[model samples]
Target: MTGPAYAVLAGSLRARIVSGELAPGQRLPNEQELSVEFGVGRSTVREALRALASQDLIQTTRGVSGGSFVSVPTVRHLSAHLETGVALMAAAERVTVGQLMALRHLLEVPAAGEAAKHRTDEQLEDLRRAEFDPAVAVGEATYAANQDFHLVLLRATGNPLLEVITAPLFRVLATRFGRDHAPDGFWSCVADDHAELHDLVAARDADGAVTAMRRHLDHLTGAYQQMDRLSRAR
Candidate 1:
């Protein structure tokens, strides 16, 4: 199919999947059936399916009872789109990683303070577990849990808009500069910082929590800067 036709079909299919009209593991209509329904050729249906597959919304298999099936969205899929947008904004050179870190500092420091004033005991407990869980290693699982800790703080601010604004930044940071930009002990240090932040917030020491969070993020920013410098030196 042509680009516009392909887009229409892909979007329609994606809407169905997202709205739960077509669920995970559910089979999509066969190409012939879809073509007839959409009043398009089999080739058009195939092209649309290919587009959906690229977005990880569907997969195809060959054989009886095998066809296009909806696939579950994953964090990696979300992060990839965010990374692309960030890279575009960075324009390969004009926007330094330092600028991104500065933006984060500006938003997160005050948000942490607000969160301290507004957070509930349940939210703090969840953050505590995510930070101090002994079983978490320096791998994908640890990284995800760490991200969740920050997300909880953002949510605790009682500002849905702030959470939405910071979501993309977290995704970009995780995708581009996760553990690879930090030292082996970085995760452990973060765990300690998270614990302290939780304590400060739980005590309703808003200023203290804000300062702690700022210090922790500053350390992270410095680590990324060092990594950038080292890469340039190489």
Candidate 2:
């Protein structure tokens, strides 16, 4: 009739961790102590801790000096779960290339405008370092650089939530496209798009950034749709 004892304990602990009641790397009370505090058995305490650990909120150590400790949630840590979920959805065919393309346009069009407004000099330097050289052909290196530039652009929005959501979507596309060679000049065209976007971003022209981002997504949508067609024909 009621929530399980372990879930109640886990929920309480999760709330504490998120509320700063339990600081990152702070060791939790021992199982016996937790059991007494929550008025549950040792097994219930363990189950609760295990639940939090699975979510990467609490970590357990196996030595006498070790117990459950609050985990520091980094961007990478949070994005890892999203990446896994996206991959599964793609594999299950719950998501289509068309859908991914549409989602990207929705998220990234605003992201470009935001990046132009909020991006720092250091982030701009990172974009330059990514090097949108037109001479580079499509391959692993070009793919990697393109992915980096887009991820950096998302991060440049100064919006962690946007970065977390779209970075993994970028990754899902990269993984899908990485499986094959592209037509000649494919990467060069990609580089050209990045170059145009970079200049707009560096100019801090929010309107131009939005326009450029939309155009780039339009190109990418066509490319992905072509790939989908090719896959279906074979």
Candidate 3:
């Protein structure tokens, strides 16, 4: 009943969407109806809808039967949004490099184990296709391959949540500090680790995959931390 009218309306709508009170693809009330119900102007309702749309909570359409509807978020959409948030937090120093590495260890090691246990033939083939020799692959091609390898490994776990939650952290770290500041031979080491992990997963050695992933993270975390330090010194 106080504060900015549009912001208050947006917050209420956001809570409903988050709590599933407003189901995905559910159409919202028309502008006039919302305005009357909330005791706000039509412009305020429009602004609130715009705000929700910006957050990917709702989408709008223009046709005879179209209006604003709650959004059904895909894995890629969720991951990209989270990646933006992570990048912003890192930029603000609200989250440190240490915390990110710790989270990756918590999420990815287990994900590798799961991949070993649950990976399908098609997922395994995809993982194999993601491989690249850092020696032979150059620049963005090598970087893209490394990204694909990790992404495919996560996908192999057969858990969309793992891919959604963990992919952004690696992507942010890689873009911000992981690539340019790496010491010599770092990517070569990464390629080797990926190969070892793939073999373990392909053999369905869950524990071995976990151990290999742990070791691989140990190698990567050091490089990430070193890069963080260098970035600060500049």
Candidate 4:
């Protein structure tokens, strides 16, 4: 009962923050005020605040003028949480890393096919910019941009659920592998693949687009596996 109540209150507060009703950096009302406003006990408010703090959405400070305040969410925090879950799943052997990679390939291949059928010129332009920029480095920037390219593809699918599902996995993979370990030639290879995919999409060649995406994922899997092996050896 307490758990569900606390979750509800926390979710309500999170929604307010996401919706901008509680702007970032703004202090949350003190426990007494929140308890009165929510018609809940102070303990429940404290529980709810604890939940939000775990999500990196809020910070609690003590002393005079101290209270709960919204904090900017960082990708690193999100990635850390995601990596923990992925590690747990792997450790249980309920889901192997290979299985996860396969799932990604299955979803993304068809997604690329769908995108090829429905993608807009603007989305293609955005992808081109991310993939072809010569000034991008081989570390964090490259990894971030690589993730953005996939996100652009997912967005081109126009499926909100796909974005919601894949975004976390992408973040975890980026964090786990680290930017320096990402394939040095990632951008060039991905650019070539994207160009081929764009052509297939423009021509409404679903099969060709799917094939191109599969090939791209094949390269990614090989690179990731190689990096894993290197890390273990080290």
Q: List TM-scores for all candidates, in order.
A: 0.61, 0.85, 0.94, 0.65
Which segments of candidate 2 are over 4 A away from where they belong?
A: 1-8, 15-26, 38-40, 61-66, 177-184, 232-234
- After TM-score superposition, the amount by which residue 151's alpha carbon in candidate 3 deviates from its true location, in angstroms, is 1.5
Q: CA lDDT, every prediction? A: 0.79, 0.86, 0.91, 0.76
Q: CA lDDT of 155 in candidate 1?
A: 83
lDDT of 2 by residue, 34-152 (tens): 99998999999999999999999988999878889999778888888998999899878899888988999999999999999999999999998886575744467777888889988
Q: Least accurate stretch of 10 residues (summed lDDT) in model 1?
A: 170-179
Which lDDT tens digits does candidate 4 get at residues 1-234?
245777989999999999999988999999999899989998999999999998889999999989999987564565567667876765565664466678789789899888877788898888776664535555666677778878888888887566656666656555554334555676677667767776777677878989999998898777777665565567
lDDT for position 74 in model 4: 60
Of 1 and 3, which scores higher on TM-score? 3
> lDDT per residue, candidate 3, 1-234, as tens digits?
457999999998898899999999999989999998999999999999999999899999999999999999899999999999999998888998889989999999999999999999898888888888877898888878888988998988888999899999998888887467788888889989989988999999999999999999999999888988887788
Whose TM-score is greatest here? 3
Residue-level lDDT for 14 in candidate 2: 90
User: Candidate 3: where is the Cα deviation over 4 Å?
Assistant: none
User: So what's the TM-score on candidate 1?
Assistant: 0.61
How would you encode candidate 1's per-residue C-alpha lDDT over 148-207 as one tens digit per residue? Answer: 888889888987666655666756655554436566566677788888988888898999
Native-referenced Cα lDDT, model 3: 0.91
Clashing pairs in model 3, backbone N/Cα/C closer than 3 A: none
For model 1, the stretches where C-alpha displacement exceeds 4 angstroms are 1-84, 133-136, 231-234
Q: Where is the poorest 10-residue window by lDDT in model 4?
A: 173-182
Predicted candidate 2, C-alpha RMSD: 2.8
